[model samples]
Target: MVAYGFKRWFSPQIQDGTKTHTIRGHRRRHAHQGEELQLFEGMRSLHCRKIIPDPICVAVLPIVIISSDLIDCGIAYIEIDGLPLHRDEIEPFAVSDGFSPDRLRGIAPAALVASTARETMGRFWRSTQPGSRFEGVLIRWRS
Candidate 1:
C-alpha cells in the first residue's frame, strides 16, 4: 500500500515545499476480519460515519492518509484514502476530536535514534517499527 501526505507552508511568501511522504509499516492482521482499515486525522478521526475499506492485496492496497487543508486552525490534517472529506463529514461520528495532539508529543521511543532532528526521524520511522499498528505523522497543516 502507498499513501502520500501534503503540508501547506505557513508563509505563502516563502518557497517551502509541501512534505511528500510514503506510508510505511504495519503488518497485515486478521483482526476486524482483516476489514479494520483505520485513519487518524492528526488528533481526530475524519468522523465515525465514514466507512473505509481494507484491501486484501498487499501489492496494491488502498493508501489511507490524514491531512488538513484549513490553515487557520494550524491543525494538521489526517487523510485516509486521500479522499477530500472535511471535518464536517466525520464530526457527527467522531469520538475524540478534542483529544490533545499526540502526534509529536511522545517520541521517547525514538531516543535511541540520537538527539539530532534528521537522525531522530530516521531512527523513529525511517523504517517501520515491528508490531506497530499505525504509521508516523506525515503532513502537518504546519510544521
Candidate 2:
C-alpha cells in the first residue's frame, strides 16, 4: 500500500469529506486508479506536533488532476476516497508512537504525501530549497 502523510489540522476536512483533492507542490510518482493509499500524520513541528504513527485514513486514488503548464513537474490534483480514523482506535497507537493527546492541541491542517510519491517530491522539494514551489493548481469537478 502506498502511504501518505498529512498534518493533523487537515484531518477533519478529510474525515468530513470537505476536501476532495490534494494539490501537491511537486510532481511525484504516477498514481493509478484504484490504488490504495494509507494517509498518516506527518511530523512537522511547525504545523503539527503529534506524529500519528498509524494511518488516519485509507483512500483509493481514483483520479489524478493535470495542469495546463507547459513544464509541469508535479502532480496537480490527487482525488481520494478517504475514511477518517476513529479517536478511540487512534489514541492507543498515538501513545505507542510517543505522542500524547495533550501535545496535539492547536495545530494546523495536516498535509499528505504518499511514501513513493514522497520520494519523488522530496527530490524536487530539496532542489527548490529555501522556497516552496507550490502553485495554484485547481481542478473543478463536473456534476
Candidate 3:
C-alpha cells in the first residue's frame, strides 16, 4: 500500500472526508488508480495517527506550481494536467484543499473570513521561493 502523511491540521478534514486530495512534489514512485492508500498524520513520530480508514486511489494528475512576485499571490496559480485553473475556480479549489482562511492563524477574524481562495492559496504557497517552479502530482482518493 502507498502511504501518505498530512499535517495535524488536516486530520479533521481528512477524517470528515472534506479533504480528498493532496498535492505532492514528484517522486519516482507514486500511487495509481485502484490502489489502496494509507493516510496518516505525523508519520514516524510518537504522535503519529491515522487520519482516515484506507481509501482507494481514484486519480493522479500531473501538477505544476509556480511562484512569482509578479503575481498577486506569490503563487502564479497552478496547472493540473497542463491546464491552468480559471480565476473563478481558484477559491473553490483552495477551499477543497483545506485553505479556509478562518482555520489559519495571525489574521483578524474579519479578514480571516474575508480572504479569498486566491489570497489564501497564495499565502499557503508562500513557502516556495519566488521565481521557482514546483512539479508534482495531485493525488485523489475516493471518500
Candidate number with greatest TM-score: 3
TM-score of each: 0.22, 0.33, 0.84
Local accuracy by lDDT, each model: 0.28, 0.35, 0.76
Model 2 is weakest, by summed lDDT over 10 consecutive residues, at 134-143
Residue-pair clashes per prediction, in order, are 12, 9, 0
Q: Write the per-residue lDDT of candidate 3 for residues 23-142, one digit (tens) a residue.
A: 988777889999999999999999998888899999999988776657665456679999999867777787788767755443323432335656666655664434468788999999
Compared with the true structure, model 2 gives a TM-score of 0.33
Candidate 2 structure quality by residue, lDDT tens digits, 2-105: 44455465565445444443434334563333444444555434453322222322232333232222333332322222333343433332232222223323
Runs in model 2 deviating more than 4 A are 43-143
Task: Name the 10 consecutive residues with the lowest summed lDDT in model 3.
Answer: 105-114
Model 1 scores a TM of: 0.22
Tens digit of per-residue lDDT, candidate 1, span 1-143: 22221111111211222221224434443122222233222223343221123222222223333323233222233345555347554332111221112222343343423433223333333243443234433211211
Residue pairs whose backbone atoms clash in candidate 2: 6-111, 7-110, 7-111, 9-109, 10-109, 10-110, 26-74, 27-74, 27-75
